[model samples]
Target chain A: MTSDTALSVVFGDKISDEINDRVNSLADSLKKSGIKGITELCPSYCSLTISYEPDIISVNRLKRKINGILRKEMSVRSEDSVLWEIPVCYGGKYGEDLDDTAKLLGITPQELIKRHSQTVYKIYMLGFLPGFAYLGGMDSSIAAPRLSSPRKRIPAGSVGIGGQQTGIYPMSSPGGWRLIGTTPVDVYNLKREEPILYSAGDYLRFIPVSEEEFESIKLQIESGTYTYKSDEAVRK
Target chain B: MIEILRAGPLMTIQDGGRKGFADKGVSQSGVLDNRSMNIVNILLGNRKDEAVIEMTMAGGDFEFQNETFFALGGADMGAQLNGAECRLYTVYRADKGDKLTMGYAQKGCHGYIGFSGGIDVPVVMGSKSTNIRCGFGGFEGRKLAAGDVVSTGAPVSGITDNSYSPETENTDEIRVLLCAQNYMFTQKGIDDFLSCEYAVSANYDRMGCRLEGTAVEAVNGMDIISDAIAFGAIQISSDGMPIVMLADRQTIGGYAKIGAVISTDIPAFVQHKPGEKIHFRAVTLKEAHKLYRKEQKFLRKLSEKCQKGR
Candidate 1:
């Protein structure tokens, strides 16, 4: 599609598992093509935006190259996807809005936590902030709306629900999502080589934990000894 | 080296920007006015991607710790070097202990100050531009403050005392390319967006420029599935006010975008201050590309001339 300096290739008009998979596979193929002048490839829920240097390659030529690549069939292997199990502490000072959110959903705090942790969620994309993943797949029973008024600061590692989706905040910032829990793991670390923990095709599962367990995990993370659990068998 | 005596408003070190990081949710945070920043760097005979100090509105006091050449571009901030008035788009020699001071801008919103060898800052994530939101690049990923000491590399040799100024053109109408979601807005809404003059809102920042004018409401609503956003994407919020995303914009957005500002006109748009009125003119993608190629040719010729002067 027409844009200022980039060409946006939209796979679908809505967010779905098939659309996300197509977008991811297309991004992989484009990266493998070794196309020159492509400065950045940004993938979202249903589209991939290619930013390139106009001086190196004209837009028409780039479009033709991409179209030629798209004609070939490509598939992402299941082993390439990683599923991370993140430990979260719910219902305390860290999750101040947990009770209110449960009340709105007409469920107890324990039930809400159980339902949230039971299902695995897929990361649609990373945006809003660094390392912050836009996740999909939440139980309709615990679906809740965002706060009417946004808080000035939402602490890092906060797990919140907005509309029908749930996600975590990699860093502290202003937000309006209803907080349900907090994770002890560092989803984003600037000192790390990759910085961000999850990618577009990654999966995340929330595991409920106690306050003591959360503190212990935090200590291990700070001491540089914590290891994240990943399941590589899960395929989309 | 240079010591900041008074850091006024917001000042940050920036280069061309951190590219190839949008997938990780990182924005291309760089100078707001690309043309002006490039002009200052070219005038100082520095590399195109050399880091420079970007001052917003007003400039601060800086004491030169070493002898070097410096150039000013973009907004006219009423700069003075050791009690002598300095002209815009011209390079000047600064000796040790010379204090450079700049007042508030007479016009425009941002200014660029470039040294002969450029400012010295560690490159993080493949760039020296400060990602203020993430707090990781360009001088500890924060704005310049008083008492901060910044260093510079050795100046380039064989540079003559020559300067070039770009022709001043009054920019009131900016060109925009209709995007994929242009159909989301009604025909009347699209007409209103192009016909009306919108005033730059006071809530504008490096991330985006919010406009206050006739609300261009979508036929259904402004909600859309989150999609990739680019620099100069005009996203109409739920309230119907359009916000033009900038260099420091988020990589993705959920609002519907009617169009994107053309690259050739982005420099002029970014230099506008709050309360400034501007109109949008729709141009075909082919025309926009032609204009971009013409601008690049001019810049290449200018660089060649500067090299000859050296």
Candidate 2:
């Protein structure tokens, strides 16, 4: 058995699927094993970074311990999930790149919008910035490349798709993702007891909302009374 | 109180560092050169986490509005008290109206000036370190300039000669850890990364230091997705040169990081001014940890010695 101090190691390149499974398993392991020193475990597509106290266990040895458990890792069965319905108003003022993306795909803007919104995407990761979600499972027909030059500043809650991945920018930042729509839902709110609206492994379904509904939801969120609901996950 | 008579580009006040704030998308904005920052604190007989002034490569001039003791460390910036040459990593006394001028840095880019009692600055997110990205901590979230007067809390004593001097083995060659992403590059790329000499580009700051070197290429087929990045991670850009992210590096990145400059070597690497050639050689994570632990031990010893001196 490897010492608790050894650093955990994961194998191979592009181990996204396996990495995600290992992360969920490790969370259970930490709880059941009563492990000490770990303050947090942040899991990504390919790696899980466990932040711990140096005095408890040095990073060098901790990495080895992680690699040890990964050798005989048990498969992580999918857990019950709450499907979050995000209402996004597409095109016109909300989406600046919708028309250009439609032209590139050689399809009408309405067709592009319908194709883009049809699928229920999974939030694979939440990173790059505060509250930013890396959502996967987008239609390839409407897939578009990032802008040659990124916009200097993209507003918060700007829903966009880059290549096959779609995401909602949770903060104002420089982004290359082609903006297709805007969501009034506050993806991140510091004032809220829980700042982030979505977490990794959650499901997100984009439901088209009217401009009037977008305004009403925005005001409700600002006033702090917007209640979010979850639905049954579509079985694989 | 000490007044800035002249301030160079990117000069700011710094303390130990601000850690544990990455979840908020805030980088650990602290003194880029940690060794020198610690040395400055030791010279003044101050605690390890005391606030100190961090000056960049260009140099700056300051005046003691009141008689105070300060110590210089990090770069051999040729600091002078009233036009007299002073030694690096030693405490010196300056009286009121005495102007201290910093000449061009000879070996390093940053120089630290730690006051006797340490500067009294409001701590933001549990640090006095300047965060230039979010514009939050240190001097109204901005760099220092001429005429800015900073006050110290209380006076500390300058004691023995050893307490006023630096005691550690210093080297120029920076050691690093070969990253897991090293396989993304070709064999020649790895060879070039180790053998080829690179100069520090002028496009450098707290965020990262870009190296101007021979093109380091990726393998015929390898593309990397963004992942968790830390301080000292040497990320090779699409243009093929390496950029070592420093205090204010983004929490995550997409660029392939072939290696990370060991934490111990980062102080020296930060001191190398533009046009100075730097070479890279990789070591195991154990070796890297050894180096890091060695520095920490040295720093603790230095602090202990300083405390005993007073």
Most TM-score-accurate candidate: 1
Worst 10 residues of 1 chain A by lDDT: A72-81
Model 1 over residues A81-154: C-alpha lDDT tens digits? 78999999998887999999988888899989999999888887888898889887888888887899999999
Candidate 1, residue A180: Cα displacement in angstroms equals: 2.6
Error in Å for residue A37 of model 2: 6.6
Alpha-carbon TM-score of each model against the true structure: 0.95, 0.79
Minimum summed lDDT over a 10-residue window in model 2 chain B is located at B158-167
How many clashes show up in model 2?
A: 16
Q: What local lDDT score does residue A115 receive in model 2, on the 0 to 100 scale?
A: 85
What are the DockQ scores of the candidates, in order? 0.67, 0.19
Regions of model 1 farther than 4 Å from truth = A77-79, B160-162
lDDT of 2 by residue, B1-310 (tens): 8888888886898887776444344456788988777777776777776888888876689899887887788877788899899787767778899988987778678888888889888777668887765565788778998989999767775443544454554455777777767888998998998888899999898889999988888985334665656668888888898998888777656788788787778887998888888888777766766666777688788778777766
> Interface root-mean-square deviation for each candidate?
1.3, 5.5
- Cα-based lDDT at residue A23, candidate 1: 87
Candidate 1 lDDT at B111 equals 86
